[model samples]
Target: MGKYAHLNILLAEDDSSIRSAIKAMLFDLGIHKITEAADGEGALQNLIRTPQGYDLIICDWNMPNKNGLELLKDAKMRAPSTPFLMITGRADEESVMKALKSGVSGYLRKPFRMNQLESKIKVIADSWSEMA
Candidate 1:
């Protein structure tokens, strides 16, 4: 029914409304295995605690305590091959390129629909599986 059948997704978002919306959308797409963190700090803590619990991580670029880029760096350093995606309102070319070079699996701009989310998830899932 969905492009990605089953996956454990880590979502790091500071906004409560967006977090709820994202979870609802993902659930609607038949993805229920999700972990939420309010900020990058909490996201990192979660990752460190459960390193292999997730198949992918969707992180916000800007947050109160550690930002997404910082979190991405930390995650890659810790897990090395874990795919970390950056979903943010910042859509500038410089930021996007920086994220790619920093080992971000993918980047999506804000105000995106559930379809966009699904597509990115599928890409990450497919690539990760291939690599594995």
Candidate 2:
């Protein structure tokens, strides 16, 4: 099992296929406990409902109700300790810079491999461990 197997993750994506794909990858990585949201608004609601907060949050860049960046900003206020990963097709420098500035734990370009996802999650886990 991976180090993050016990993590409780929240995945927000408007596209069903993309969301399913990521969920598969998360499962392959041994992340079994996952909560899914169709948009940033739903993600924020989930965050609000959970008192302890999720272990990690993964979101897509574009969505109908709200965008990933918006959720990230709001989540920071409510669950600052939660690690957030933004997965998006928007690889432009400006978008990447904005995500970083908004306190994203990791930013992933679309078409990412399972290893890439695992690596990013590992980095977050390692950093959190160091802090603890």
Report the number of the highest-lDDT candidate: 2
Clashing pairs in 1: none
**lDDT of every predicted structure (CA atoms):** 0.89, 0.92
lDDT of 1 by residue, 1-132 (tens): 665547888899999999999999888888888899999999999998994667889999999899999999989888888888799999889999999999999999998999898888889888999998
TM match of model 2 to true structure: 0.96
Total backbone clashes of candidate 1, pairs 3 or more residues apart or in separate chains = 0
**Model 2, range 1-132, lDDT digits (tens) per residue?**
877898999999999999999999999998999999999999999998988788899999899788999999999999888889999999999999999999999999999999999999999988977876
**Candidate 2 overall Cα lDDT vs. reference?**
0.92
Model 1 TM-score (2 dp): 0.94
Clashes of each: 0, 0
Question: What's model 1's overall lDDT?
Answer: 0.89
- Each candidate structure's TM-score, on Cα atoms with residue i matched to residue i, is 0.94, 0.96
